[model samples]
Target: MTTTVETIRKGRKFDQVLEGARQVFMADGFEGASVDDIARAANVSKATLYSYFPDKRFLFMEVATTECQRQSRDALDSIDMEAEPREVLLQTGQHFLRFITSKFGQQIFRICVAESDRFPELGQKFYSSGPAVFRAEMAAYFEQAEARGQLHIEDRILAVDQFGELCKADVWPRLMFGMTKVVTTAEIDRVVEGAVETFMARYGV
Candidate 1:
C-alpha cells in the first residue's frame, strides 16, 4: 500500500484530536466537555474539529478507542510469544494490572461508567474497545497454548472468563471505589502466582 504525505498528516491530526478529546473528557466528562473545549485544546477551530468529528459523542468514542488500542498493543508487545504458557500469562497479567492502575485507564473507566446510562452507544463502544478486546486476545493466546499441549482447555470462552474472574477480584474493588490503597509490585506478583496456579491446576499439561 502506498503511503501519501497527506495521509500521514491527516493521521497525525487525528491522533492530536483524539489526545485532546481524551484530556477534555477526563477533565470535564461527557456532558461538561464541549466541541469548543476540544477545539481549543487541539488548537483547531470548531469548524475544523466538527469536520473531523461529527459531535462530542463521536469524539469521545474515538478517544476511548484510541486509548484502548494503544494499551492493547502495548500489552501484546510486552509479552514474548515464544515463552511458556505460564510465563506469558503471568507477564500479560502484570502488564494488564499496571495499565489499569495508570491515570489514563482510571479516567477512561470513570468516564465510561459515569456516562453509560445517558449514552448507551458510548458504553457499548467502551466495552468493545476495552474488556471485550482483551478477552478475545487472551482467548487467542489460550488457544495457542492448548495447541502446543501446554494447556488442556477445550473451550476458549470458558478459559477467557476464568482468567477475567481471576483478575477481577483484585481489579474491581480498587477500580469501583477510591480505595486509596495501591497495588504494589509484590501484591501483583502474588495475584499472578495465585491466578496462574489455579488456572494451571485446572488445565495444565
Candidate 2:
C-alpha cells in the first residue's frame, strides 16, 4: 500500500496531540487541562490544534482512546496465534504487563478512573474499545484452543475473565495506585508462568 503525505502528517499530528494531552491531563486532571496548554505543549497554534480536535473533550477522548488502542494492539500483536496455548498465554501476559506499565498507559488509566463519573461516555468508549475487545479476543483464543484439544475450557467467557484476573494480580493494583513497583521482565515471566500453570491445571491438554 502506498503511503500518502496527508496520512503521514495526520498520524504525526495525532501523536503530537496525544503526547501533549497526556502531559496536561496528568498534571492538571481533565477539568483543568486547557486547549491553550495542549497547543502550547505541542508547539502548535490554537488554530492548528483545533483543526485536528474541535474541543478539549474531543482531544482528551482521542488521547485516551489512542493509548488504549495502542495497548490493546500491542497485546494482540505479541501473541502468536499458532503457538502452543501456554506460550500464547505467556506472550499475551508479557505484552499486557508492558502496556500497563508504560507511561502513556499509566496516565490514561488514571484519567479514566479520576474522570469516570464526569465523563461516563469516556469510560464506556474505553471499555467498548479496549478491555471489551480484548476480552472477546481472548475468549476466541480460548475457544479455538478448546476446539484444537489444547485445552478444555467449559466456558470461554469465564476462562477469559480468569485470565484477566491472573494477569491483574500484579498489573491492576500497580496501575491504579502505584502501590507496587514497576513490573520487571523477570516479574512478568514469573507472573506468566504462574498464570499459565494455574490455567493449565484447570484446563489443559
Candidate 3:
C-alpha cells in the first residue's frame, strides 16, 4: 500500500524513518545517502524502514511532499478566502515569500536543483508537491472571487500564474540564485502590494 503523509504523521515508526531520511538526505545527497544510515539514525530495523518506503527515491519523494504540505498548510492557515481581495492576496503573497526564503525551503530547493539532472523525477515530484499545488489553490481562490463578483477572470489558471510571478518578482530570482539572502520584509510587502494592485487592476470587476 502507498503510504500517505497522514499515515506517516500518525505512526511513530513512520515519522522516525522520515526524520532519519530527511537528515541523511540533507547531509548526503540522494545518490550518496544509504539506507543503512537512515535505518540506523531512525533506530528502526531495515524491515521497518522498508515497510514505510519501498525505496530511497520513494522515501525522498514522500518526505519532500510531506514537508511541502506542512509548510503550505502553515503559511496559508491564516488566509481568509472570504476577506477582501487585496488583503487576501497580500497575506498569501507575504506568506509565500517568507516560505521560499526560509532556511528549510532554501535547503530543499537547492537539493532539488542540484540533484535534478541525476534524479529528474525528484524535480518533478518537488514541482507536483509544491508549486503545482499552490497554483491549483490560487486558481480556486480566483474562481471564488469570480463567483462573488470581486474579480472578473476570464482565465483563472493564467491569472494565478501571472499573479504568482508578480508576487515573486525581485524576490525569488535574486534569492534563488544567491544574489542576496536577505529579502527584507519591506521589500516583500512592496512586491506583494504591487502584484495585488496590478492583479486587481486587470481582474477586478
Compute the lDDT of residue 159 as modeled in candidate 2.
89
lDDT tens digits, residues 40-103, model 3? 9889999889877765766876677777887677756778878878888889888887777766
TM-score for all models, in order of appearance? 0.75, 0.75, 0.74
The worst-scoring run of ten residues by lDDT in candidate 1 lies at 2-11
At residue 11, candidate 1 shows an lDDT of 44
| Error at 56, model 2, angstroms | 4.9
Error of 2 at 95 (Å): 0.8
TM-score of 3: 0.74
RMSD per model, one decimal: 6.5, 7.0, 5.0
Per-residue lDDT over 85-138 for candidate 2, one digit per residue giving the tens place of the 0 to 100 score:
988988887777667666556656666676677666666777787888888998
Mark the regions of model 1 whose C-alpha exceeds 4 Å error after superposition. 1-13, 23-38, 50-58
Clashes of 1: 0
After the best TM-score superposition of candidate 3, give how far the Cα of residue 67 lies from its true spot, in angstroms. 1.4
